[model samples]
Target: MAMFSTGGFAQHGKSKKVKNAPVFSQVVYQGDDKVYNEHPLKAGEFYNPILQGCYPDPAITRKGDDYFLVCSSFAMFPGVPIFHSKDLVNWTQIGHVLDRTSQLKVHDTGISAGVYAPAIKYNPNNDTFYMITTQFAGDFGNIIVKTKDPFKGWSDPVKLNFEGIDPSIFFDDDGKAYVVHNDAPNRGEALYEGHRVIKIWEYDVENDQVIAGTDRIIVNGGVDLAKKPIWIEAPHLYKKDGRYYLMCAEGGTGGWHSEVIFVSDTPKGPYKPAPSNPILSQRYLNPDRANKVDWAGHADLVETPDGKYYGVFLAIRPNEKGRVNMGRETFILPVDWSGEFPVFENGLIPMEPKLNMPEGVENKTGKEGYFPNGNFTFTENFTSPQLDYRWIGLRGPREEFASVLKEGGLQITPFPVTIKEVKPTSTLFHRQQHNNFSFTTTLKYVPKSEKDLAGITCAQSERFNYVFGVTKKDKDFYLVLERTERGTSRVLASTKVELKEPIRLQVKGIGDDYEFSYSTGGDRFVRLGGIVSGDILSTNVAGGFTGCLLGLYATSANDILVE
Candidate 1:
C-alpha cells in the first residue's frame, strides 16, 4: 500500500465525467442446508454480519426510498461496485464505476491496492453525489466523481491534490462540506510502507480541493486485542445529537480480528472507544468445535427513514470444507445502540436472487429458484443486470473489465494468453454456488491454436484448477482437464472432439470437490474430472485477495498475450 508522501497528490487535469452510473442488482441463491450461515435470521435483533462475502470497507448513503453503497475492489475491473436498496434490507446491484481501463493503471497495482474504502456523499450545494475512492493505495490520492442519478454519469475522476488511504466525505449541518482522508504524511518518512498511522484531512467541495481545517490523526493504532497485528483505516463520520463520531474498522481484515466502531467523539481530542469497540467479530461468534475460522471487516453505517441504524460489513462463509468463491461478502448488521455505545449485532441476511420473488426480501424462501425444476442459466453471454449485486470479485475490479450486459453479456477478452502471464486475462467469473448445487453450461470456442484456448474451470488457485477445454491440435480438437497442482497437469485427459459440436459441461458440487461431467450430445454428461479444487485452499493460502472464482476463461497465444 503506497502512502501519501509530499504535498499535492495525483497528476491534475480536466476532470471528465463517465456517462453510465452503476445499478443495483440482487443475487438469489438456492439449494438445501437451509441454515442462514448455520444459523437463522431473526429480526429486531442485532443481526451480525449482515452480508457474507467480499464486500469490504462499505461506504453508504441513503436517499428517499433508495440506498446506495460502494465497496473496495482491489484488482477487479470497474473498480467500485455500486449497489442500491429500496428498504436497506434488500439490495440490488446496478453497475460499476470506472467502466474502462483508462480509469486505472492496473499493472502498477498489486494485491489489495487498486481501490480502497470510498466515501459516498450527496452534496446539496452541488446537487450531486460524490464518490471518492483511493486508488494506487493513496499514492495518487483519491478519485472524485459526481452524479445526479447514481445509476449513471459520474464526472471523470477529478484527481484531488491530496494523498491518503480511506478517504471520506462529510456534509456538515451548517452546509459546509469536507473530505476526510487517511494518511499521516506529516509524521515522517515511509515507515512500515506508510501503513503505520492513518489520519484525516478536510477537503473543499466547492473548489474541488483540499481545504485547510483539521487534518489531525484522531484515532491512533487500532485495538490490537486479537493477540495479532492491527491497523486502522476506512474512516466515516456522522454527527448525532450534537456529538461527532468518527466510525472505523479495526484489527486486520481477516481471521477473528475484523470489527467496526468509532472513537465516541471529536474532530480532535478526547475520543473514547465505543463500549463495543470490537462489537462484531466472527471470531467472537460461537467458535466451531474444531476451532478454525476467519472473517473480514470493513463497513459503512446507514440509517433507515424511521431512524433505525444498520451496518453493512463483511464476513466469510463455509460450505462444508469448501468456502465461498466470493470471499468477504456484504452482510447487514444492526447498530445496537441499546447500550451507551453502538455495536453491530450478528446475522447473515441471505442474499436474494431476482427470480425467486426476492427471498428474505418478501420473507419467503423454499419455493422458486430453490427447486431442481426451477430455471437458472449461465449460458455463455447470459446476463441479468438487475440481479448482479450478488456477484462480487474478491479484489479490486479495475477499468470496465466486466459486465452483465454492461458490455453486452460478461464480455471477457484476453489479458494474457496463459495463467503464466500473472494476469489471467480472459476471465469473467461468478461466485461458486454455496449449497448442494449443480452447474452446467455450453461453450462455443474458437481456439486459434493450442496456445489460444478457452475452458470451464472450478478454480481455487493457479496451482489448483480443474480445466476442461477444447485444445486445438493441427486441425482437430480434444476435451481436456488439466490439474496443474504439481507444477504441471497432474490429471491430463484429452478426448477427440467432433468439429461440428459444442461442448456441454456439468458440475455437481456434492461432498467436497465439484464433479465435472462433459458431453457432446448436450443431453447427458460424462464424468471428466473429479474433485477439482478440493477445498477453499485455506485462507491467505492463495495469493490473490479473493476466494476461489468459478466461471469461464480464455487465453490468446503468448505473442498476443501482452498486447
Candidate 2:
C-alpha cells in the first residue's frame, strides 16, 4: 500500500477563484524493487489477502526464519502450491508439491471434491518436510508427501488410513508423532446434521501407518459440546508452554465459518475448549457484510523468529450482493498472546483493508513473491522454452498433454468432452485475479475436422464455464460461444469467420459484466457476444468451492481415432 505525494486542499471560496490543476498520482512504490504495486489502501500500510483467489484452508509453518505455506487447491492439478516468505508479508511461490500426475488422483472429480485442507510441517530432528492432504474423490483418504528439499522435488506419497478429511500431523517434545483429523459420524450417532468429531491417532513414521487401537476422540462435537456443532474439521495441533493447543474450523465453511481452540495437558486429550471460543472469526460482526469481506476461518499460526505470532486464515471478499467470484483467499492477522488467550486485531471483527506490518519488516516492491506491478497483461508468445507454472490443467499434469508449439502459442490436444464434462476434461487455465481485466490469446490451428476447436474459456467448474472458441463445420470456420451453469450449457452465440492466419480471442471482465471479442490478425474485431453477468462464473451461482479460471483451451470433444 503505497501512496503518491500530492498537495492537500486549495482555497475555493468566492473571494479567491481556484484554477484546475493537473492531478498527479500520489502512489509510491516500496519493497526491494516494487514487485507488488497496488494503491487500494494507504501508503506504507500492507493489505490483506496475502495470496489471492481460491487459496483456501491455509496451512503454514516456519523454519529458521523461513515461512512456507500451502493451500487447498481442490481439483486444480499441480495441487498444494508451496509459497515461501521471508518477512511473512512478501511471499513468492517456490513450487508445487503435487506436480506429477502419478502423485495425485483427481481425474473425474468435481471441483469441490478433490483436495481438502493440506498441512505442511518441518521436522527439524530428521530434517524432512512433510505435506499431508485429503483427496475427497479418490481412494486415497489421507496421504503424506515428504521432501528433503522443498524447492527441488517431493516424494510420491505415503497413504495413511483415515476415515475423514483435513488430516494434520504434529510432533511432540519427546519425539513422538500424532495425527489429528475429523472423524466421520458412525451409525448410532445420529444426533445432529453434519455431526462430526475431531480424533487423534498415533502415527508410526517408519512404518507409514496410523497405529491401530490408538484412535480416540479428543474434542467431540466442538468447543461447546452442548451446541453439537456440525463439521468440526480442519484440525491442527500446536504445542506451546507445555499445553497442547488444537485449532480447528467449525460450523461449515460459509457465513458461520469460525476458528476455535482447545487446550489439553497431554497429546491425547480430554481437551478443554477455551473459555473464549472461536479465537478468530468475522461471521457476525459486520452489518453490511454482503458487499464486504465475509467467512474467515481455518487458520494456522506461525511464530516468527522475533517471537511475534501471526495467523493465516481463509476469507472471501464478496464482489456484489454476496456473490463470491474470487472464492476464498489467504489473509494474515496479528495474534497478540499478551492477554489470557489469542485475540486478533480489532477483537473478532471483520478484517480491515490495512493492517499493521510486522515489527522490523521491510516492504519490498516488484519482488518475486509479490504480484507484478504496473500492467496486468499476460501473453504467451511461445518463444519461451517452457510453460510457466501459472498455467494449470484439470486433474492431471498439463505437460502430459498440453505442449508449446514450435510455430507459436500453446497447443492443447483434445480430451473426450468439452468443458461440459467436468471430470477428465483436458483444459489449461489461470485464475482471473482482477474483476476488471482483459485476457487474450492467439490460437494457431486449422480444424482437421469440424470437431477441432481451441480458444478462450472462463471456467467456474467443469460443469459451469463460458467457452469462446473457433470451430470448423465441414469446410467453413465459425466462432463458437457457449455458457454452462450447473450442468446446463447452451450455445449463446456463434458467427462465421474467414481466417487466413491465427485468430486472437479475448475476454474482458468489467465488474459483473463479461464481453467476448475476436480478431483475425488485424485491428478490426468482431464482438462474439457480451453482457453476460460475471457472477454466473462465480461460486455463488455455479455451486462450487472454486473461483473463475479464465485462460486458453483446446479440446477434441469427439475423440481421436486410434490407429
Top candidate by lDDT:
2
In the range 170-254, model 1's lDDT, one tens digit per residue, is 7776777666556653545433432434466666766777766556666556544333235666777777766667766666666
TM-score of predicted model 2? Answer: 0.88
Indicate the worst ten consecutive residues by lDDT in candidate 2: 4-13
Q: What does candidate 2's lDDT look like per residue over 69-90, in tens digits?
A: 9998888887888887888877
Could you estimate the TM-score for every candidate? 0.76, 0.88
Give residue 70's error in model 2 in angstroms. Answer: 0.4
